[model samples]
Target: MKLQKVLSALVTVLMVALLVVATSASTSAQEPKQNDGEDQTNLDTQLYLIVATNQSVADEKLPAALDSVVKQLRATLPFKNYRLAATLLNRVKNEGRLDLSWIGAPIISAQSEVSPLTPSFSSFKIRVVKLAKNTAGETVVQMAGFNFGARFPIQTMSVASANAVPVINYENTGLQTDISIREGEPVIVGTLNVGPSGDAIILVVSAKRTSR
Candidate 1:
């Protein structure tokens, strides 16, 4: 009888041990998995627009902060003379807006529009379509549905006349590109011809990871 009681006690202990083990396994399964040195957090990207011009404009015409960028571009780009026409700083998310405006010589005009486009002011409306990381671990951003507008002078340019103010408008829905930028690192995504007189606009983008 004593031996039988001892065996019963042993069985109870074994059952309790099994129950504890099962509970531990279940709890672990319900817990979130740990990230082993992988970055699972979403990143916030910042975009900086650097508009370089071959012709120098008054310092008062540009934002005060752009003076440094202009100095850097003068040393880097092949242009003998370049000035920072405009600087646009923006942040990135699922969907955002980028509005840019600058006063300079008009470089691009619609073919259907009259010649000698005299618009000296330009503006852009850009939409951020998507932001995702690619398989190669590069953060890619896609932008579309962008439009560029130029204010024309009162006069119009034609084959007979060389002077005219003609407002030019263009839509670029297919303006999309992939950019890989680390925190505080700037990369030039692309360039736009701002003037027929050899002036160009350079777009520099940068990003940094933010806490959720």
Candidate 2:
């Protein structure tokens, strides 16, 4: 009976020691799970995005555009809030722009000048199309002649796929267009006809410039 009692005491002590050790380990892990210093370091490392919008686009549109720009930023990077600005086209040309600029001291200067919707943005333009009309109210197009006449540029431009007609028309057309491809290559645009309404598409085509 004495031997059995001693053995029972040893077993109880071993179980108590094991519980204490496990509790200590768990407390240690929980204590360091959220360190203020480490959290501050993470915040310091977060990135930023700068958005630029045209003066013509309404202020209400800014919110929707901002949401889209934010979604794009999230898809490309890991961040939340982004900077917003309303800038002119001329200013964008002179200044650089971006929707998401990594926060770092080295690229700060260049990031300040970048406009998110400038010619330098990737996926800007691979194809170009425009439509116009004369005084007679005849439908004008850059490439086509009829229902299919309005879809010529997409059919011919190298940027467009073989069967990708009209898909790249961009619907609207104007008088003169200056489309800038990658490497600052300017593709001059001209319109051949307008629609039957005779309302000539009088517009100055320029490289699309927006901060978003």
Candidate 3:
């Protein structure tokens, strides 16, 4: 009976020691577990879709935050105007996958009074996402199999024929590539030429930790 009690006490002490070690490891901020459970870290990402067009327009100021991006675009791309298309936010755990499908909403045509425009489809997907700190002390988000695709209506031609309507065709375009973005900094993923027109779509993305 005495031997059994000694063994039990020793086991209890070992278990306590192990638990203390675990507690210390978890609470050590220097050894961060960014890929841990949702309760431990924030893995939400925000993406901005901007349309770059050759068509000039008034009030063409993009968000001041994207000023650097715009300057770079102007130096490289031939687009004369930029417009904000959409802003999307999605949450993903580390090394997890996410896909979001878009349902295009129908809107009445400004040119044609007879029918509403056809609905288009758009989607974004990522096969795997990871988060880590870079050598520059910035949190970096790395995404693999990043894909953005869409189909939209485009007017083929305008005619003055009596009792005739303009021809519209659906065009499919997208961009697929891997991307790495630093926290709070917008990174341009890629661009897709929208249609026969000189317009293009630019995809900008950023990520942040909502640990607060």
Top TM-score hit:
3
Predicted structure 2, TM vs. truth = 0.22
Q: For residues 130-205, what per-residue lDDT tens digits would candidate 3 score against the true structure?
A: 8877788877888889998887777788777886777878778888898788877888889877666567788888
Q: lDDT of each prediction vs. the true structure?
A: 0.52, 0.30, 0.76
Task: Point out where model 3 deviates above 4 Å.
Answer: 1-39, 105-116, 135-138, 158-161
Clashes of each: 7, 19, 0
Give per-residue CA lDDT, model 2, range 49-92, as digits (tens).
Answer: 24222222222333342354445544654333233322212212
* For every candidate, C-alpha RMSD to the true structure in Å: 10.3, 22.8, 8.6
Instruction: Report the Cα lDDT for residue 28, model 3.
Output: 94
Tell me the tens digit of each residue's lDDT in model 1 across 13-114.
999999999999999999999889763544454444444544444323434434555566667786644434334444454446567667654333222433
lDDT of residue 63 for candidate 1:
45
